[model samples]
Target: MTSRNRSTRVSILSALIGATLAVPAAFAGQVDTAGIQSDGSYARLVVKYRDSARLRTAAADRVAETIAGAAARAGIAGGVARGGAALPLSASRLRATASQADVVRLSRALDANQTQALLRQIAADPSVEFVQVDRRLTHTRLPDVRPMLVPNDNYYQQYQWHLHDAIGGIGAESAWETSTGEGVVVAVLDTGITAHPDMDANMLEGYDFITDAFVSRRDSDERVPGAADLGDWNPVANECYAGSPVTDSSWHGTHTAGTVAELTDNATGMAGVAHDAKVLPVRVLGRCGGYTSDIADAIVWASGGEVDGVPTNASPAEVINMSLGGGGACDTLTQDAINGAVSRGTVVVVAAGNQGQDAANHSPASCANVINVGATGITGIKAYYSNYGNLVDLSAPGGGVTDGNPDGYVWQAINSGATVPEDPTYGGMAGTSMAAPHVAGIVALIQSAVEVPKTPAEIEAILKESARAFASAPSQPMGAGIVDAPAALALALDGGGEEPCEPGEPGCEEEPPIDSTPITSGQVVTGLSGVAGTEGLYRIEVPAGMRNLNVLTYGGTGDVSVYVSRGSEPGADEHDWASTRPGTNETVRVANPEAGVYYVKVVGESLYARVNLQARYN
Candidate 1:
């Protein structure tokens, strides 16, 4: 893929599936305009006005009064957070959309299709800038993946193939050398993270944004601090509806959060991409998935915006990762929230989706300025279940089932029990849901390495500019090729200054073929492993009579070994041995050689390359 930008439109999809985030679970098949918990005829609307001035002054009340009057005239009776006509439950339907603004999100049971007419009334009002109704979102899990697999305390070498994937992994190994994502915060708007032993060190106090009492498993209808995953399990007995069925809890947020900032090199569980990054678990999803209103509020609050009724967020996140999405055009509410976040310098990353269809139809991912991530299999091709289309910003190891091996799925922390949140354990689950966090983790890493810290736009530029080219282009366009951590980090560590390149421009710095291309001494070059049996050859012009020489290889996964040979192509007979036990890193050192020229051959035990190679002569 080239660096040339491709056609893009602002859009978003729904979230929640596979224990991931978003999508009110019970609504997976319920597309009617009913509120997530209401019997029917319930809709949430986001209304904004043209006059930004009147919003912050005494006129704010006047603008709101005008809106309330218009709604009443249009047969709408709900007040802010339900302060309108009757039923305290109305409070659940009304709330200020933003602080110091007439922008308001109001919910009410309108006559069938009457919500659009109400929006039209609101839009016709002289003070209104725009209006949008919330759409229904649902979550669905697919068949499990299978793979042949490892165990590491800080390493989980075999299981975390996605981190070290030679072709599609995010390239975490080398990235850690430059930045461990020490100071950045990633706010995960999902079911909230579990209290996993592997993630406690990097976890921060968060909030519960699920406002629906039934969906939140709460006795009251209020949101609270301390976001915790109580398991989004729907009982077959049907309290949510007449026929809502029971399903297994995905513990999806646990998996997503674990991937983003799970404790790394801690001698337990699996390694997170951004080891030192802190995760702010925002509970936007629960029992049946989550309400769009709650999700939208979380997005705004995470980026440091004020959502009335919720406490002011003191720990605003630099990066926001939403793995859940729904199908539809970008809603004004969600879009506005994302816009506000990006404007505030927060990098938002979302999954393209697992529907295996064009991603143009998904929210959040379709939304503007978001990094929509698609899933790649162990083979580096698009994952079978991943959604595609021009909307995707990039691809990452979402993990795919290979030969019925479950290990093909990206593995992370999960609950031990089936229906309830329980003991911490680990498992592999596949979806575009599993792919978004990889890039979010890297965003934290990039934020950590830069001096002044990059704006979301600049961070995205570095990510696209330094990404490795795909071994094989996906059937449909995937964003700027797969994400390459080490390469991206190197550019970031150099105080990145690359602009956002046009998508799919060939022969650019981002898509160079370096594995087989030889380079001179000391300069670091980026390259990929491609397929099995392919090797990168590097020639270093050794100065005559050099006392010592060292060849080192770090980053990528699989078993890649390095061999150095002088006076001939490096092979079994002429090379000095420097094999180190059985790990991903390789190095070969030579002493006191009469130097002419030396060649380094990188051999993969199982088709790996995407490595950072360096040769030093003294």
Candidate 2:
């Protein structure tokens, strides 16, 4: 491709795929041809048939005979057919990748009437349940025009104040050295990623966990075998009658993956935050919305599978990116499954949701172990659609429709073949979904930069503390602040000053202690204290109207606990320890008590504690 063309392709892919954090898995040979539309020239066929309980011997011979007869009568260059238990019928499609001239010749040869007759004959065959012209590819094109890399001057000035004089300029090279994310795998749980030129080189093994085969194959049968290296594009299966069959729409995963690590500075397309990181495409959402159960299973499998009879994923992912969420109370089962993954060293990142409502209005995003992300515009202003709350860990560039900012929106391409609007370079879009991957990609970069591997908690801390704070931030609900890739990577390599804390020991004199005086009804008293010899521990009285209470601390190597009692005294302590070493805060919920004084204590075995207390009223 020419430089200009390559640039356009890169820009388009970058905007669509963006950064992701997860592992790729070996591709399963499942042929999913969901997007193929019926056109006059050719018809895509889905054949359904019953497989007998007998061995493959009978079916194999029958399919072989049929193939030989078909090949003898007509000119067939290449095609695939196989027999397997999962396959419903002996199915194969006659396809040709021809140029425009070749297409014209082929169309004339088949003729309109001849083509109709051929389709009828094929459909009439008992083995073939369906046959229709494949037309989805006809309209495919490189996007016609480039997207606005930076918003128009008017949009930038009037509404996009966040990007105005932001620290990083467009294409501003980071002083921090580039690092390799080659081995780390990021699993993107979203709408499927369309195959694009920019992603071909860096894309790794991935499977469609949404399918019945529990593999990445999109087709239900192994009747046809194709290339091994290519990933499967399975649409989510329809569970309800009202739900449409799975089809690729927004190309959400592709965009997120490109951002996380899109073969940066390869003299072709846009640079990714961690260009070397490998992306694992895990399809979760399809037509309308994905199910909570499927999402839960995807999480388990992505983080190394085998959660309650769901097959153990063939490949384990180090990080999983979930850019989808639904409204509901956080499910305990889901939370436990996530925690199980975290305990296994898989970092889970979730979108805070795009509703612009409180995060408590959502689920998995509201789960404790996951890193909940909110959205900021190109100019650094919070996107109108970004969901926020104390649950949000940080924010990143999630493009906005109304306001425009350099940082407020990402400039990248949409999948031209998918239903989403296709733009060459940049299109304005917004969501916590866009913001979550920014952090996931940053995590990949940090993992690449650091010598000693950081735990998920430590990685989260570096990102949160190193974020760029917006001067006019709307609320603390936005979390620490917008993500800063360079700053976060720098902190990661520098170790972020993490150390062990001990009980009753004079806390880090340098680090501020968590001190609270007023300690009101619904407010938490928070501070960081050093643990000297033993783990750090602290106690406070839970005031009235405080229905729940918990503690948060950093720089400890052991378990932590939160104790609560109706009276101003310690009861049986509820120990909620960190699952990993070099841990960050631990929270415990306490039931509301009668109007009277109550005690809340935080203790860490063998370390000092930097504590942040939080309380919610009944």
Candidate 3:
């Protein structure tokens, strides 16, 4: 994929009136004494009343009361309380006033021992659901350097360049065939983006759902009302702290957004796969790990806002990209919200996770409604750190841990200044996080090339059928196979065309009995000793009401595979199903098998070995 370069320029537009408002910093006298650090700067307090039945009516009141009582006892100056569903109780950031005593007294009063007592006292209240120290945020670091790209390497190029080649390149000659991702608005739910050269022209309207302060600025900016800044909220900076500190890691969000829809062919930094598609930036993560409740709100808002406080999202996104995950089971509330997004015609795409375990243990990605994407190396093999499972829908190049080749992975960085580099600049990184955007880009390309809008089910079907299966991939690791852009686009454009089988159809006919043996339930169908391979070929007939059909091989050393089609003569290399493995018994299930006599071919695994077959339905 060739990279594009555009001149860098920065534009500071007039701020919208209501867009620049600052949140009030009044502490309702709540002092969160649980898990206060020795430094007296940070404390871990479990949020109170996260899911109270009367939360809608008295949430603010309950939070205010808790803060007031804690402040009075601890002699804390003031503090801030934020709502979070993931925690059972409200957490506060408190400061000890001068009258309260010196730093030593404050520390002694709110130390671990005191904190435990405070928790016990708070638990006596029936309204308080639970309380515990807020856990500190942690992250696994990625190597900080650009990976080297091999010479003339086409495979490692950016997604857009490959897409351009698939559509016959950049001039008017290819105008009619050019792909534009219509009806596909991708939601970049991450840290806020910096107005970089490549992204300034492509980004759509987005909001900071993280800091309630509503000020849009960089991380280093002082805590002033109505000030815009970049970076995560730092709770230690202010007494009534509601945010975390910003760090270099915060740039991840901007970089990811650029890869999905950076302005293309404009001689800019780099071309994104679907340059014309809109991006909905939903800020969720900040300095420390964001609260689950905030991330949940971002999801709902990105999907068109089913919850209150979030204004009704104007342009409901068609795709949501969550590059973050936590160690936990799929939560009911979170999963329900994802399902709600899908029901509203949105396709949620999530990282398979960087944990290198089966994704079933994680939330959202493991959730049934979204598409879980795993990471692949430049050589088209699975990335060492990528998680895998039957739940994984597909795989894409996510740049290897130590094998950066062909310009590494050069994507736009979030919060990068106006002077960001242009050309095929490389930055090496590995994780399922990088793999997801590739799939999102492919989905955009497929949508752009096809006329009819495909449902999530149809899109998934097309992707699975067009995937390039590999024998070297681990059984549960790589999924159906690596993603093929050209193949996927071709399938999308074909409207997933169908073929038929039966008497009168092109390659249809009746078949003679095999090996002079009569068919029986327990007997395995063996080699073609009696029947002619060409003249005696017959298709298995499927009846109605059957949702699934399976073709099995009882015993064989040769390859055995199944194909389902409406057409008797299948198109070149377009079999509905194909497998190359030999086993004592192998079963291939066909979903919603159609009512037709579909050809089931059994080929030899090795030229000299014989294969046997059997069929079952459910």
The stretch of ten residues in a row with the least summed lDDT in candidate 2 is 1-10
Off by over 4 Å in 1: 1-42, 49-93, 99-112, 136-155, 237-245, 401-403, 498-618
TM-score for every candidate vs. truth? 0.67, 0.52, 0.61
The better-scoring model by TM-score among 1 and 3 is 1
> What is the C-alpha lDDT profile of model 3 across 77-104, one tens digit per residue?
3333364323222333331111111011
- Per residue, candidate 1 scores C-alpha lDDT tens digits across 367-412 of 7778888888777887878888767878887877353444468888
Candidate 1 C-alpha error for residue 313, in Å: 2.3
Model 3: residues >4 Å from true position, as ranges?
1-177, 211-229, 232-247, 401-410, 414-428, 469-475, 497-550, 553-618
RMSD from true fold, candidate 2: 18.1
Backbone clashes, each candidate? 52, 68, 44
Task: Arrange candidates by lDDT, descending.
Answer: 1, 3, 2
